[model samples]
Target: MARDGLAAHYQGEDIAERILSALRAAQGADARVTAEVLAPLDHFHGRGLAATTEMAARLDPQADDRILDIGSGIGGPARWLAERFGCHVTGLDLMPSFCRAAEALNAAVGLSARVRILQGSALDLPFPAASFDHAYSQNVLMNIADKARFFTEAFRVLKPGGLFAVSCVGAGPGGEPFYPVPWASTPAESFLATPEETRRLVLDAGFDLVRFEDRTEAMLPARRRMLEEVERDGLPALGWHVFMGAERSLELVANTVRSDLAGRLTTLELLARRPG
Candidate 1:
């Protein structure tokens, strides 16, 4: 799919307003809007806030650091990291709607001073070389066909000795994943690399691999439960479905879980550092 097509796939109308309204309905009209409160709704990837939390732990960002959130969807992790670590975070994504919503949410939570949102592509980041202290991307690689350029751009932007953490779905031994998954509606938009290929690309991009894990086996049980819950009771009121639409979101989640169970998909996590 072309860049415009991919952006169109993820775009939503009045995203920030809808998200805020949902939160109000769930937690009273006057409840405070904190990152924790918005966790269930804004983190637009697999496993939601839990995945972001794990990536943060691996990055181990410091209070004074300047972090870059590649493919930041609605700034959930960016706001969370800025609030929790007292760090400045710049979130970049391709979808204009996501960027606008992220900015609005940042202002809503009083993190506008700490979190910044930009609209851009992962293959071509909009920053200068050695611009950030650390960076991370969650579930962003599947949409990017040029994996090498994605990793290379990330490597180029980080300061020497900076960390780059990534969590994404990789191709498993059983072949292609089921269609209409969260990242893409069809195979044309999804470009998954195997675990071995992903490792090589990171290394070839000049990152010293600190940790790499194929977490599929360990995460399958929880994934199954999530699918079951969605099947039985439908999507929760405060979930990704708020923006993705209930029926489409349900189909996406179901396909993702079914693909995983069939060994056609694998979850991957990597922590790498730039050699000084």
Candidate 2:
């Protein structure tokens, strides 16, 4: 029963309220994003962002480089990259509201001059060839059905010798199916590719796979710790209000653990070169 629609309910005040309430509940009274404008849920996302930044830094782009963030959500990762690496960032996402909020948050953080978001899909980015020095994404590939097209677009925007680093949830060796993210009924409309399949797709799309790491093992222990912490404190008491009211959140976590234990879902990172 995976829901195939674009989780687009996250528009306008109603969706904003739900997100804010969830943030307030999980973050206690002092979340970073203001209650008026829903910001990217950073507590749950920062660790991954940090990991991506570390990986991208290893690429060693020049200080004045421009980077693209595919499927950037609320611009947290983009801002993180800008602040940490002194790079100008442009974020693209299919959600207009997300783009607006991302811009607003960038302005609020006084990063508007360096970080920005545009309403665009990964399938068709509005950019000229060789526009970016580096491109990176996190947790986005699982939702994109067309891996070939996704990599094609990523390759299209990047300059020669540019680096592309991505982290995503993918099917394990068995090639399992999808379920909705926690608290939502049904599964995601998209399919998660196997690690080998993903690597082949990237290579096919003309990227030189510099490094590919299957971190499914690392994610297992991390999720177990998160579950233990959440169980000790109630959902509201825990710092995960972002997914609040989605009773299925716990279910999703359980399923993720099950999949990881069974080697079905993996957290993998891929580093590729656009070929100078």
lDDT of 1 by residue, 109-218 (tens): 99998899998888888899999999999999988899999999999999999999999998999989988899887788889999899999999999999999999999
Worst 10 residues of 2 by lDDT: 35-44
The best candidate in terms of lDDT: 1
Model 2 agreement with the true structure over 1-276: per-residue lDDT tens digits: 332255532323333345556666766767665312232353223244457557666666566689998988667677766776678999998767667767776775678888878888898889998999999877778767788999999999999999999887777775563354431234445567878899999999999999999888777777777667656753443323343334555555556666666776777887999999
Candidate-wise lDDT, in order: 0.91, 0.69
Please give the lDDT score at residue 204 for candidate 2.
96
TM-score of 2: 0.81
TM-scores, all candidates, are 0.98, 0.81
Q: Which parts of model 1 have CA positions greater than 4 angstroms off? A: none
